[model samples]
Target: MALLKEASNLKLITFAAIQERTENFSYGELDASNKPPPIQVKHLNNDRITGSAAQKFCLFRLFPIIFSDMVEHLKSFKIYLILREMLDIILALPQRKSWLPYLETLSINFQCMMLELLPDKATPKVHYATEYTKIIEENGPPLRYWCMRYEGAHLYFKKIAMQSYNFKNIPKTLAQRQQLRQCFLMSKCRFLKSYQEASGNKIIYMHEIDSKVKVLLNHRYGSQFIQSQTLLQCSQLIHNHVIYKQHAVYVYDLEHVEEIPVFFQIIHILKLNQEWIFVVDLLNTDGFSTKLWSYRVSSYDRLDIVSPNNIKYYHKGLDLYKVDHFHVVNLTSRLTKTN
Candidate 1:
């Protein structure tokens, strides 16, 4: 049965489809991406999924195809919508004061839904979740004060101290070790790996490129680029530490924090004068398909060129799928705007 055309909003799913839920969604470890890292199937399969993994799974993986199970259980689906909106506003740091009121309403609705559907399962954590809006309004974005990064660093030093048995003057030992490591990194020039790297087996030259792309290049760069014998081209781009592959989704426009954002898929990755350019096809921004729990986007024929520097969010790159006649994109993360 097809959706967005047929009467079926909730479709039956296979067991394999359920098993591959987390497997189907994956993202890189770029900072500000706030995406869950690559997880092993065994560790995250079935009962093994709990704690932070469950939260990550709920916020990232589970929502994409949630509509399949929502029709029969409308109350449960209402909870999902509330949580989805909660995530969109909360997890997206730099929480706006204006959105806090709407967040309060979402939280209240979520509480009522939980009480109505599964009151026995509602725990203290749910209570804490309701306070997020108030906390943000009083203390600013919670992510700004998150110690996870610092905790990771501390763990590294803890391992070193434990292995070396350097308890005496631990601070001094840590300082010396860090200094040596810093010197080693500087000497090896590993710190400069932040530069973009073009990946893919095929190498494309200017003449070998599409006529439309050539026109775009000439129109934008003129002879400065047209005179060049060849241009650097690739099917994959690694910039700002995030991996962007051809046809992958990235936010082109975050119109409003409360509204559904617009996305564009990278049609081409080209480089000229040491700057990377992305030729992209904009996704239709009518709104997300609530039944699919994914953004239903009709691909555009007209191509637009954008720069990596001009990207609003550098951290997350989403995946786009061809679902029947239209395309759908599963956003594995929130739209947290950044320079």
Candidate 2:
């Protein structure tokens, strides 16, 4: 309390509130849809966060979820919102050319906001924001040249070098450790995987499946014998190291801009014919709720079977949040380049 009072010039009260919210923020394990492992970034505001770039990026993406309920009227908080828009632009894969102007506008707005609101705190990072659109224009999307993987790869050697206490032939020691680690990891099933794979333990008889899904499958297979077979289905399916669970929402269509961000909820995860099939219920996007930073959706009874490989956009799915008797999806980014 004393320290916070002494730092009144920093608006520590708001900072403390956000820190408390972040510390208490919780989500289910199935909620991992490109979500980074949980990290306590409260200390990061004052002290350096000792983690990889991926971890930082993860926390950064979750900022909207954490600070969504904060005072929106705050001048500085608007800067955070602008930065989030920039993040969405930067992190996108197959970055579109149309987004460059919007990115430049956001970057300029971010810099001006920082200078106008917190004059003394304007840093070089803010200035760097201006050059993003220019660089992106010349070299194409900056994500094409991202070095996050390279940065992450260095962390392993750093840990080994700092902890081994072996100064002699340091390069050789790192090489030996790297070889052993890679060898062990590569020996495992699906390590550095390039193929689609799925596993689940729950078993259910086909006759016991939902009447609607059973009917749909039977019609597709041109027989009623599907009811005679058994199914190995689970509430959650681990596909290529990513978790896809029943009831989680995923992007199923990204072709048409009108329906570009279509989503479907996995009503069931089934394995048949040596392939993973998701029995899903397509969801219609109602609208976006900025207050929650999620998309409001309405579920339809129409059921369809889709292979994970068939998904056109980002494969990682978003868990639904029930707000005001409706389901909402917190997608990391928009496919529309103008966003």
Candidate 3:
């Protein structure tokens, strides 16, 4: 199916009867007003098969042919990454109760790929394979979320300084751009009329959280939390509550010297030592590409939410950069927690 699709797109012609070759086989002779004639062939079998035979034929024969061609074109590096990440996700499959055999098979495939990619003894990346396996065994594959932001940090600096072309005053030009950009970002916090306008006024109350639920609010807003049976003094409320089962939120993220706002989903409400807290999962942005389908909070992972009031919005998307007011719920059903 993939071959047929690619062949159709690429306009590949298979000639069955043309055995003769001439010097005049140029665009003038072969081209018939850009419309190539189709080759006809006789079929061997016309009998239709159903049930298991049909399914086996479709699954083993049809899909394999499609994926085989697709896989053939992929670069070695790309193929390696795909295989590695696939094994990583499999290792991190939350419910690995009866999945030991499957995990072993995937691990074998990953090991085989590693050998193919790094056959020599002097390769540095070969060392990562050991670390990768160890990390997966310890932390259930960390999946793609483990290092996506750290990897993405490399690009942020590149994007910020890509336009610096001053040969004589390269340092001065970069410093000036960085300063101006940061100052402009900080200025947005003082006047959040733009942020408020972009992110609507729909709100969610803290009372919605069950009394037994754990909350983890940021230390910045620790003083605002007042003890009360029915109502709290802080009155935790989030915007656009009705649109999401989980609230889309912004919080301060430390990126180098500047603390910019990052978008995330509030997955759980928690409390420790009388401090109201929110357990948030990070969202993938243009700056960072992640394979996380949704944010799942497990007992193993702890994230302290920053005060929403202290969040400073970036000027790129007016209020929300990368995310719009459009509602998108995280894949919470697939979320799993380990004891």
Models 1 onward score TM values of: 0.69, 0.77, 0.30
> lDDT values of the candidates?
0.65, 0.69, 0.37
Q: How many clashing residue pairs are found in candidate 1?
A: 0
Best by lDDT: 2
How well does model 2 score by local distance difference test?
0.69
- By the lDDT metric, which is better: model 1 or model 3? 1
Cα miss at 177, model 2 (Å)? 2.6
| Pairwise lDDT winner, candidates 1 and 2 | 2
Off by over 4 Å in 3: 1-109, 113-124, 136-151, 190-339
Candidate 2 pairs with clashing backbones: none
Model 2 CA deviation exceeding 4 Å by range:
1-20, 28-52, 158-170, 180-194, 222-229, 234-247, 255-260, 323-326, 336-339
